[model samples]
Target chain A: MPLYYEKKHQVQFYEVDITSQLTLSSLLNLVIAASGEHLEEIGVSSEELISRHLGWVVTQYHMSIKKMPEKGQTIYIKTAAMAYNRYFCYRSYWLYNEDHEELIEINSVWIMLDLNTRKMVPSDPEIMLKTGAEEIRRPQKFPRIKLPKEQLVADKSYFVEYFNIDENEHVSNAHYFDWMISSLPLSFIKSNHIKSLDIKYEHEILYHDSPKSYVHFNQENNRSYHKLANGNLTAAECVIQW
Target chain B: MPLYYEKKHQVQFYEVDITSQLTLSSLLNLVIAASGEHLEEIGVSSEELISRHLGWVVTQYHMSIKKMPEKGQTIYIKTAAMAYNRYFCYRSYWLYNEDHEELIEINSVWIMLDLNTRKMVPSDPEIMLKTGAEEIRRPQKFPRIKLPKEQLVADKSYFVEYFNIDENEHVSNAHYFDWMISSLPLSFIKSNHIKSLDIKYEHEILYHDSPKSYVHFNQENNRSYHKLANGNLTAAECVIQW
Candidate 1:
């Protein structure tokens, strides 16, 4: 039998856009929720998926925003293991109309590690067997990132929007990624496998002030260095890898 | 020339899901917000969209979900006029990435609706023109929903999970729809266009009790109906236009 898992999710009124289609972000949300459902179904809670010392960490995803369904569109999500290799585990995703036929696919990889020691751990063989692993491990790889100019520093500023702040009262990581990656081209986005992204905040980005930006890029290593500023106030720095 | 209307929006975290993606509910929130944005960008306000005891109401929508970007994706939206005639006007939507490439597309029709009267009105020519009239009025249409059937009515038996309850302390409408529609085959969902849905809640669905359910389906009309038992007391009637 083909390896498959399916879960049903409802589209709330809030999910609809002017064209009545679900936004791309919302689609990812449903995909995550469905993945949660799958884990829950198999008696693998987020708590269980974690290492004895380390929590689960999502390092990088080379996801394609291929297609989105409409608002109030009932989505059926399917997920399965493609392989467990190298420092990462490969998983595949498919979203389809309720019928479980036509599919929209998302592919990603993740890892298990000792949280306290912060070292990669061999995946639990028992857990892997239960989750249906048929393949071995290999070195993780991704496409190169196309960075912009090598020396573009903060000149234009951005006033933090109220929505940019999350429940944590900080600029959300997702928003930061969106803002950063958006300045680049989709050609770059589609081509790269995000390696590791390290972002550090030197200061809080407030809602009242217009935050300016600084940027640096190196095409050779495919790294992008970024900064956010407001007047002389420095807010944050990020180094993206692919 | 192509019609143009710019909209400004904010990003909220709760609107996103576990995959750390934005959810459909958040997309709907954006739509609502964009309405205000649209008017503001055009040098008007929602106050103008609302006439003397009148407002534009969405009667029906036929849309396709194309793609959902990741969480925190900040997209630019614009509206254009497709057609307008007499009491009806058609609108088109473009969701663009920051670089200005269209990421999502949608089409809809609106009416100069009388709020209190709940009726379409033949508005002034200049007003329609200002809104970007696309074409003359035609029959506003969508997939037809089937009439609901009365199935076995049971009372007081349901399980409410932690996620089922939103901040509102009641079962979310999305979850309600999820359970209501789950009973039917995925095939029905595949073939049918969800024409319309009307639901009224008489009481709160608590997390404590197992809520009862009644199933109803009419294949000819392509609809499945549902009712929830009220604490072994009474039930709420639901109508689904499939």
Candidate 2:
């Protein structure tokens, strides 16, 4: 078993929405940063990886939520690299309250990209060993996400700004989640709490790309299907169980 | 002298821009939240103030920046309620490095508002007393700000989203700073760092209000004047020295 890396965070007022609950995108960003810190402690800093012309890109996330962290709530974020195959690395993240009760669980898929070529590259076993993740022959399967076939319920266009781009010079993955979730109606967002989320990123969005986020809500299943697209090209697709 | 409350913060990755330096708006949010915590600790919580149909609204800010915080850098945030007159209260904030070197200093004006009537109210000396601040007879003078009269350089329309609103049911004040700064050209933002900033809030922007951010740049002075307006009505105005 891989050793879990843990970090503590107190939810700030600015991180929450009007409902006093932490925004979904902010929660994801916190956990992702924790993972980055974990890698830094293990001597595999993102900067070092970038210097080597390689970087980890998240392809998918499957999250199960017990309770969304609220403003001023202190929680522990834990992450570990579970296993890796030739092309994909499997990782897990958990959020727990101070009392040690799990608040959220997430399983994610990451693949190394040759930054110079912008193509998938084989996993570096030497680096994976440093993270204490076991080598696996087969990649783990994540939940499949499907956009609803029904008519679109809402859509909003987002003009990418300089702040949206990270050090990678591309729109950060978590902001896509923000755009997707914010596309829904305020009434629907206030009345519902997300129980689970499954998202798959298909394309990288660069600055100056004005992507439109579309949402389709399935009332029968309490599910919302979302798609973020730059013109006709889909950038991300997500399914949220409310 | 008022007691200064100090808070320690390690800049998170998400708080920084592509250049790895903290965003201007994020820095404001961090310090503003620190002030909220300071109020909470003083037993004059914002919630209690709101419950009494009272709220503190920031009217103006004058900031001098020595350096912007960078990602992964830990710094100290300090705030103090300096003094209050009949209507306006003066407060100061400082950001310091670990060596106690001052990085940023800000002077701000705040006014008490009657939330139910949405009108200005007299200062609540009882609440001010708890902060260990003095009751001065006269208000402190802040630097005057004037918008440039030159032709408009850039204008961008922003649609307020659900997440933009805070617990107060209005667009969070710090977000206005984001919109103003983002309206400038990315090239300019990348090349220049703000030396000082003076901003005044004129009106509040609500959800569904599509405000246009306009910028006027004075090339001779390296200054940018900004205004956010809904149609012809102004919401906020700012001037930044680079």
DockQ for each numbered candidate? 0.04, 0.76
**Can you write out model 1's per-residue Cα lDDT over A1-242, one digit (the tens) per residue?**
12457777556445433334453345555666566556656666665655356444444444443345665567888887566764566666777887665546666666776867867776666556656756575654554333343577553444443344443345543344444544444355545544445554445554446666666667888877776665676555566666
* Top TM-score prediction, candidate number: 2
Interface root-mean-square deviation, candidate 1 = 16.1
TM-score of the second chain for every model: 0.56, 0.96
Candidate 1's displacement at residue A175, Å, is 4.0
**Model 2, which residues run further than 4 Å from truth?**
A149-154
Best by lDDT: 2
Could you tell me the TM-score of chain B in model 2? 0.96
Q: TM-score for each prediction?
A: 0.40, 0.97
lDDT of 2 by residue, B61-152 (tens): 99999999999999999999999999998989999999999999999999999989999999988888888888989878888888864676
Candidate 1's DockQ is 0.04
Residues B1-242 of candidate 1 have per-residue lDDT tens digits of 33577764334345643334444345544554565455456544545656466565443343344444455466777676567767766666666766677755555555676757766677557655555555455654544423244454442245553333443345544345445544444445434444444444445575434676677676686655667665654334455556
How would the docking of model 1 be graded?
Answer: incorrect
- Which stretches of model 1 miss by more than 4 angstroms? A1-3, A16-20, A98-103, A149-242, B1-242
